[model samples]
Target: MPATSHPTRAAVAWRWVALVLALSQLAAPAVTSALAGDFLASGATNRALITPAGYAFGLWGVITVLSAVTAVVIVRYGLGSWWETGILIDICIVFVGFSLWLVIAAQSWLWVSVVVFGVMVGALAHVMRKLIRHRDDLTCPSWAATLATVTFGLYLGWSSIAWFANVAAAFLDEGWSAEGWWWQFVVLVLASVSAIGVTLMLRGTLGYVAGVLWALVAIAVGAAQRGSPVLVSTAAVAAVVVAVVAAVTWQRLGRRARISPATA
Candidate 1:
């Protein structure tokens, strides 16, 4: 029943570095938004924060908050441990990569930015899995990890959709018309399926709910663009699929809880 020792100076210094990096990234959007006056607005040539759908693109806040929490947790628990090292590495790589992607995207390297963002998302997923396995070692608030996992997963899923949207938008802007309406239908089906898969993989009903909200927000933005009915319809379908999946998942989890003992 002895008290644990505090983290070493090195660990504390690393956490401070993480905090600084995270805050810098989080503040970038506000700086750009103020100085450039919608330069990063949706469809703008310098758009880095806003997507084609005009969502505020606040994933940076989520990323920053998570990174800060993770850093604090590592500092308090001593990153000398294997689990702490692994988690710290994951957080650093993913967050730094994501911040770099924002810069690339802002420079109009859309395709390169998309790939980098995808890698960041994959890294986040890996980090979440590792955290879940070592959940007991995490000393932060439960809500911290829960929010981090859910936000990271949903953001990844949504960004995947946005990546395709960016490609499609670029193509359209370049005068490449779709061969037929069928392609739009295909996009809709794929988006819906991807959302459902991501939701299920996260195993959180709130994650699915977040996905649905994101889908709807995307659709609303698409509608605002005076886009084709086909595209709008696709977004609508994706939202519906997310909602239904979330409901089913909630019911299944509820049933399992009911059949089990409260303390078991």
Candidate 2:
């Protein structure tokens, strides 16, 4: 019998679905840009303190590259197990939803952007939970597991912070008073706490933590550019605190992974 005949109909169907989703990862950026107009300009129109530096948005390029890498990984190895397939589905939702978000934002539907972000982040969170729970799955080789986890982890981490920023921008668009510096401080504090909480929950996945740290540092830089000394200091402190927790969590996860090698 041919090797292709071994998989059942469902397995074959899944392979095709996985391949399409992986390709979508590569296509998302171009489609998003075409439909959404200039994301940075849109962001600037309703900018808030939580907003990171314009350059910080460049992380999307890193993500796109990682997505390309993930696409190649999936094609080369195939979906090794249901766990991987599920993660792929959730990630596709994120990419598609994010494109939708930019389109909506372009129309100045600020509240709608918030809701869209909420949905996208929820999908990302689902992927994170699955990755954390199945970290040691023997069905997936080390390289596949690492690549998937890191890719999704980065997505979730950035989306987590982006969600808060979306909400703030929405509020600002409504002419909600951000008159005082204190409100921005409060939001920054809340974001930091939330990032740290998620990091601890995920056992310090390096990719996710790196995403969070990247956004936080970028937020500080943006604040500096805006000449808000107080905001800059607060964001910097938050980044440092999250970094410490992430370092510890990453170490712990590594130790656990080594001990449990094949014991997902």
Candidate 3:
């Protein structure tokens, strides 16, 4: 791969860009809060059944720290591989989209924010999938690449549940009440299933599983507090199911790792 060659100036520039973007997330809470409200406050104001508790939003802090660390790793060790370059570009897009989302949300463009959030998720997912698929192929330090992969994986995992919450909030904004809405519960089920599916597909990437589980657990907690017993039950069930799937995925990944070395 071309990444096996010397890192080019362009690659170095992208690496720095990625690093800047990562650090900028540390400011997102203050910036977004000033523009409108903090992310959790905004979601709470536009309450939805799937909206997680305030504690869940704390994941943003964790993700921000991990992102900064990953960016520094990439800048230090990125080998100009195509995947490295692609990831840098995609991650930048995610952060830019997030800034745009804050503006859109401030304007109370709930529907528009929905669309923008989807695009951000897609971009993050692409970066994460690429890193996972090509992890072993990268010419960069494997530990560095793995850290980058986990950072994006965690981002994507959180976005999976968040996207649904965003959709539910949009519906509420448009005056669509959850009252008498059996289908809303169905949507929650779908959200859980989707999380499980992604974890399975990713072969139990630990960061991804951790992110999804964190959100789901928070959903259950928030639902119980909000007196949405049905949502609480659904989210609890989903969390368990996701845990089981992740365990299976880990086993499979372990088996693959064991067998591949023998074949080699």
1-264: candidate 1 lDDT, tens digit per residue: 123345555556666665566656666666655644553454432121112354535554664665566555545444333355555555566667766765665665666765776676677667656554455665555666565556555556555666555555445445545433455456556656766776676554464357445755565465546545665666666677777777887788788988887658
Poorly placed runs, candidate 3 (over 4 Å): 1-4, 37-46, 178-181
Q: Output the TM-score of candidate 2.
A: 0.84
C-alpha lDDT of candidate 1 relative to the true structure = 0.57
lDDT of 2 at 35: 74
TM-score for each prediction? 0.72, 0.84, 0.91
Please give the lDDT score for candidate 3: 0.79
Stretches off by above 4 angstroms in model 2 are 1-15, 18-36, 42-46, 253-264
Q: Which ten residues in a row have the lowest lDDT in candidate 1?
A: 43-52
Model 2 over residues 48-134: C-alpha lDDT tens digits?
A: 766788887778778767866776665566545546566666666777676677677777787888898888778888878876776
Ranked candidates (lDDT, high to low): 3, 2, 1
Residue pair clashes in candidate 2:
none
Cα RMSDs, all models:
4.7, 4.2, 2.2
- lDDT values for all models: 0.57, 0.74, 0.79
Could you tell me how far off, in angstroms, the CA of residue 236 lies in candidate 2 after the best superposition? Answer: 0.9
